[model samples]
Target chain A: MTTSPPLLPLQLSDVVFEAGGKRLIKDLNCRFEAGPPSVIIGPNGAGKSLFLKLCHGMLAPMQGQVTWNDPDAVSARLNQAMVFQRPVMLRRSVSANIHYPLKLRKVGKAERVRRTEEALALAGLGRLRDHPARVLSFGEQQKLAVARAWALKPQVLFLDEPTASLDPAATHAVEELIRAIHAQGAKIIMTTHDLSQAKRIADEILFLFRGRLLERAPAAQFFEQPQNDLAQAFVKGELLWWKLGKANRKRRD
Target chain B: MDDFGDAIRAALNLLVSLDADLMEIVGLSLYVSLVAIFFACLIGLPLGAAIALFKFPGRKLFAVILNALMGLPPVVVGLIVYLLLSRSGPFGVFGLLYTPTAMIIAQVILVTPIIAALTRQVIEDLWLEYRDQLLSLGANTTTALPTLLWDGRFSLITAVLAGFGRASAEVGAVMIVGGNIDHVTRVMTTAIALEVSKGDLALALGLGIILLSLSVSVNGAVYAIKDAAQRRHA
Candidate 1:
């Protein structure tokens, strides 16, 4: 008999994070259903990235607990990996770098070779396997970072602006990889400053504004009709996000 | 001055001839320093990494201690070690006085802190860049330590080379503890001192050239490794 997976793979209850006498994330409660992927979108300083980190257990909430439905079923630490905007590449061969996490997990030699090749192939880095990871172009390096995480087959993947620094072509490549990874059954949770990217990859969007998760809705609905004023003005580029949106409009014209 | 020129010619001739005494001293210096560096790395590397990675009480105090130890006077260390291994001292039972083993002990003590302190700096620098990525990947402190070390391998090699250079060239500590016994405890640095004091400029000059060459080679190796690393990283 086959066992069915739980409906909600991730849950955060009244999560709060404060740093340096400032409330960064205040009392956030959210649940991620094990269906379509989730996206987190916000203006600069919206705490969107911080919230993604909290959900991935990278940052501990000051006043809440994050519970996984099957905490015992999988290693929480091992079941998720995040790709940061600026990736860290070890001073090693590309293949060796890609195989790093697998080596740490002590996967067998043959299996590591097989999976490393698979990851490189998926990331379009098959030819440069022998090249040093650091020597790869920035776009290639970012791809390597995603491939590195993808190699682990993490059940829940957290991506903090994986495409923020990429050009359009590189952004497309990364988005495609994200989609392929999501297709493999791992839930994708990402944060982005680019609304277009949010529109492209997000099935659902969590709109964060000034440390508050103001609204959560489907991706199409979030852009079509942001429930909160901050989010609404943000979608239309009418609010000041960087300079409080007023300056953003001035710069826009 | 003529003697000095004669010594240089003689030393070059000896090196060309592969002089047995010089070879033995060179071989011994390499072996003892190597063993000392190995032990230092095995112990000091982890210690430094811990000092950098963890936030225990007195950590700043420990850092101060290591920094002080890095500049520790070798002669004082030698005297302390000499006294400890003397007949009336507690470790006299081992009969280690004036032996190569005593020299090794002194060298290890002198070099370990250097290795530890330098490695700590390297690892600490890397911690800024990598700690988050590794943690996000779910690597605990235990797992991250090794990964950090491996990633920072180039820097660690320079640390080890620095330790080796210090251990090999140090005369004061190894001399007092080793007693400069010919054919046994007599290494390059101590032999140079004895030969120079006895007005035997040829031998002293020869050994000096060897020591300088050794230093050059070690430094060259460090640079070559660094360059290779940069090329790979590029």
Candidate 2:
């Protein structure tokens, strides 16, 4: 077995992304090492999803670089995968969907089958393997999407609100799936607005406000005594609005 | 009214008897149209996908031009192909003028733009939803094209059917290029034209009825298959 070089620590420096004539993701700098899950938590329009897109190489950074420890483009690409807020099933059976990225990476047939089975078992989707992926219920489809990404055995997995639309039961199931995936050694980088969910799954927290990373800390430290006032209000369960930035700064002055 | 009744009666009798000339004409028409549609798909699917997926300069204008070509008048297409395949023309050495191949060439030209334009619409819509994911999965435009084409297959089938409809129903291109020769290049549309011009109303109407029915059955069969498959997968 030829083991590829590690793709971490993923480092982004002075990264910016613009769309619709607006700088949606401002100049940002960060580094993610090979470790536990890193959860990016912020309100709407904070550019959390855009940050993930840049990190995953789905969108090019307008100003700076998103670099990985591995320099080879093919290996760096094959070693990362992502799941969206609403999973897009390939209009195929569940098993076929799991096999897709593996096929894209050109995994050997024998290894592909083994990894596919591992993913199905990981998500408890074994019985529904032959069912059409799009025909599955929403939660089941999300599971299939995560499992499909997992089949590549990527070094890093970026999930954009993997449980955003799911019910409590389904959310629990997915949370468990994430932990299981983490246990298997892939770095998890995800974004969510759900506070309790961040508490449940996040090993580290990166907080963004208005397209900028305002604060980042280990999960426990973030929830307990957050460094930034906005983050403090967020941790204290205070309702945050766009106007809150000035109001909070005035109080500080 | 009497002529109409007689024409309907003639159409039924000819259909029931399966006259040798009638069978030959029907077979040739189906052959030429089907072959033209096949070639059109081979060219159109990829061309449409590339136009949808790539961002080359003048791509939007290229798309507009392709859509405009879908409305090309069949007689003009026939005239152009006729010019190209005439003895004095570039491809004249092949001696393909007035043959079934000439008819196919003209019909392919007529149908390709229609298929390609409609396929572009279908694939473009699908690419909107699929682009980010496929790119995240490390698919470049070349790799994403086939995946988008396959995933858009059921929709693309409708595009092909529309092209086939245009190919099988048109008369001007085949009439101009094939010359409507008996037992040589006589397709249903061209034959109906010849019969009408010769004052053989019954045979013309008979061929018309058969042509209309053929169109309906082909469409019905494709829709049935597409519906069942969509239900299973959707």
Candidate 3:
């Protein structure tokens, strides 16, 4: 029961999200097949994190539906996990933190021990097995969070700004863990403002601007020649205000 | 002042010699309060956790009511229980009035709200931190309650101890309900009250010392548990 049912080919159709009477995600339609990580790149307030949360079932779209293999949200969620920007560590030992999800799933005692040890080894936290998770350094806590999620062996893993606040070394470590998790056959849907990080890990890029899905392209194609103006500005590190003004003009026209 | 010194000396002597009457009162106090707290926790912990974690109409009002009940006067509680257990009342068939059971019922009524209110505050704060994570892990509110309670066990210990403290120290409730029946319903608080009124300062002072020691010990146990949890999780 540790592994979830097939959660591949996650689809979002006509997804509309509004908060505080403002649209945050507008008519989002996308199909994410099982494959290399799909990196979402957008500027601040572009609803990147919200989109991730919506797709991960943390937030329900005000209209439309998000389905995984046509299953209900709860069934879909059983096989998925999300890592946040600042992951919360339970007030327990590192091993206990990793063991929690397995216990929740009612995995047997033997399997829990095995998966816990495996996850700790994968995250290189074996030495800190008995240490309290809260006392870990920020980087180590993030790693532990990933390991805890990884132990569940989710089919689709959503990361919202997983490395947003980490130093270079810590960022590299977390990125490597993300890659490792992906290599283990989980669909990685990650949101990052860092274009270079997106470039390095994304098999495909989903570009968003002002709550709209602007473009979805192969990683190489997106980096070489972005089709949308906002994508181009984002790729070239230009201010998005100019592109926003152009979009406003186009809308008005 | 000389009389106070004599009382202290007698208190110490009574404690050292393990006086039977004093011991009986101490034992009865512990039994009644512990039984009350056991029942209180059984009702309060889950009630508090549910109130904190769930949403429904009038939840705010329910929470306000529980918080207000935390300050309910013990004598008022005693009065209410007395009415219920008296021979003419609805539950009078059980003949529970002026008995140890009546004393326990009064204490339970007095302590349950304290445990529930404090547990709600502690568990509510924890739920804020844990709600998203637990829900994301496929746990609904019901499944997550025990996890939240277990993780917050150290603070919950303090809540239970608080209930015990309230139950043990209160004289009005047990006195009204138990009638301070000699060798039967007599407990430390009621005994102290009786001895003090009868001008028997020696027994009163002795019982007072035992009650104070019990309070100190309960608090010490709470602090010890808290420190251990901190060290384990810090």
Q: List the residue pairs that clash in candidate 2.
A: none
Model 3 accuracy (lDDT, Cα): 0.89
Best by DockQ: 2
In model 1 chain B, the worst 10-residue window by lDDT is: B135-144
Order of the predicted models by lDDT, top scorer first: 2, 3, 1
Model 1, A36: alpha-carbon shift in Å?
A: 1.0
Model 3 lDDT tens row, A145-178: 9998899988889998888878999889899999
lDDT by residue (A1-253, candidate 1, tens digit) is 8543442468888988999999998888988877678998887888988887887777788999888876553466667788998989888889998788887878899999999999999999999999998888889999999999999878788898998878999999999999999999888999998988888888999988888888999999888887766677788886453454445456656
Worst 10 residues of 2 chain B by lDDT: B131-140
Task: Please give the DockQ score of every candidate, comma-separated.
Answer: 0.72, 0.75, 0.61
On lDDT, the candidate that comes out on top is 2
DockQ of 1: 0.72
The interface root-mean-square deviations, each candidate in sequence, come to 1.4, 1.0, 1.3
Local accuracy of candidate 2 as per-residue lDDT tens digits, B1-234: 877787788889988998899999999999999999999999999999999988999999999999999999999999999999999999999999999999999999999999999999999999999988887777788898999998998999999999999999999999999999999999999888888899999878878998999999999999999999899899
Docking class of 3: medium
TM-score, B chain, candidate 1?
Answer: 0.94
TM-score of model 2 relative to the true fold?
Answer: 0.96
Q: Write the per-residue lDDT of candidate 3 for residues B1-234, one digit (tens) a residue.
A: 766777778788888999998888888889999999999999999999999999989999999999999999988988889999999989999999988889999999999999999999999999988877888776789888998988888889889988998999999989998999999999999988999999988768766877898899878987987998787787
